[model samples]
Target: MGVVYIGDRAVGKTHLALELTSPQGNYVRVFLANQNYQNLRANLLNLDGTTKPTQTIEKRSLNVEVRLPIGISKIAVDWIDSPGELFRRSWQSEHINEWENFKEMVGKSEGIFLIVPPYREILQPHIESENYVTQQQWCNRFNRWAEFFIYDCSQARRIVICLHKADLINCEIEQEISKLNYLPHGSPLNWLQRHNYVVNNYFQPVKSELEKINKSRSGLSVRCFITSIYYRSLLELPWIYLASYL
Candidate 1:
């Protein structure tokens, strides 16, 4: 069993996957991008500022697998890091046949990691600007795509919503949770209950959107989580929860 990361461009999907699967430890990681070999290599080199003479990584599109031991047992995770920009733009094609083809390809994934930047709270403004599709349209497209992926793969329960760049808003969530507990009629005995309520409220809108998708995409389950690659402490709880699930 493994997890798949899906998000818009430069959302740190590759970086998070690498950190989780790094060889320095005992995690096995693989990268699957939508681009062809030549383009992938150029992007990596440009992003890393590596010298052309010392580029040792292969510039090819292949499924490379790695194995690592977890305590006495071993687990294999397959990671797919596709081009977010391409996926989003592919929806704008004029040909219905081509659009269906693209949708069919994405529907094969095991799970989805929907990454949204914390700084970009509302979806409307971002989607309305040039060089991007409207937020409403993006949500609709994702809903349909997710529905297809779940129906085809039979693994909709693994969907995870990741609020990336959450370090910027971690303190806010904490404060909000605390404040909710102290509300006029909030709970008195269970702090967890209060925290859960606060978290749910914070994500209520996204959850509603997901619910609309779920109606059509029936077997799929969606869960929300906050994550920040740059914040070590912010990741502790999420990692612990994931470890328990593993």
Candidate 2:
């Protein structure tokens, strides 16, 4: 499957992709991007779950090709890890060559990982009021972009709303959880942890938009995945994105 990862900067998009595709000895990984990273291999493929590079030169996107041997047939998967600026600048603005490249990738994508920050971060307000308003408008535009890919792109089969930075959310939930242990039996902490309240709240807006797409498209699927590159393993099974792809 051709999977493209799109998200704003510093949301751990590249980290998650590299973590999922790290050396299993069954795949040959290659980079097709034109930009240079300070320490791409160590930063991305860190086994200890390191999520940040010393410094990134800030490229428009990072492209990866993973060739996996499925029996005798070697299947190649192309992943485009794009910077959020692509969407920020391209929205209601000039569609530059980079934007065109992004469009083509999305057009040919079989599955897409639209990465966004955690619930609390998403709910946080922009410092500038005008920028906040612009962001809301851009979100609508992004929804339209998503609609185009789902309805018009024949190869687009699935769109997964990936909630990035699960580690942070887990910490938040745990902190709030500790205070509730003194309460009566059957405290809300149990429900919050069990139901994945942070992720569920963050996914609601995307779910509402894509529920229509799911209904309209006979075979198209819109789903959600919560992930964290920092955690050694997952508290919940869904945080492991490799399973989602394979």
**Which regions of candidate 1 fall more than 4 Å away from where they truly are?**
21-75, 85-109, 119-153, 173-201, 213-219, 236-246
What TM-score does candidate 2 reach? 0.55
Number of the top lDDT candidate = 2
lDDT of 2 by residue, 103-156 (tens): 776777676656665543343343323322243553565586566665656676
Judged by TM-score, which candidate is best?
Answer: 2
- Distance from true location, Cα of 123 in model 2, Å: 8.9
lDDT of 2: 0.49
What TM-score do all the candidates reach, one by one? Answer: 0.52, 0.55
Return the clash pairs for model 2, or none. none
- Candidate 1 local lDDT, residue 120: 34
Q: Tell me the lDDT of model 1 at 89.
A: 48
lDDT of 1 by residue, 1-246 (tens): 344445645556555544443334222233445654345456544656442331111222323333312332222334434334344444435345544543444455445556655433333343433434444555554564455444554544455566565545535645533343322133342434532543475455445555654564556555555666554333322332233233
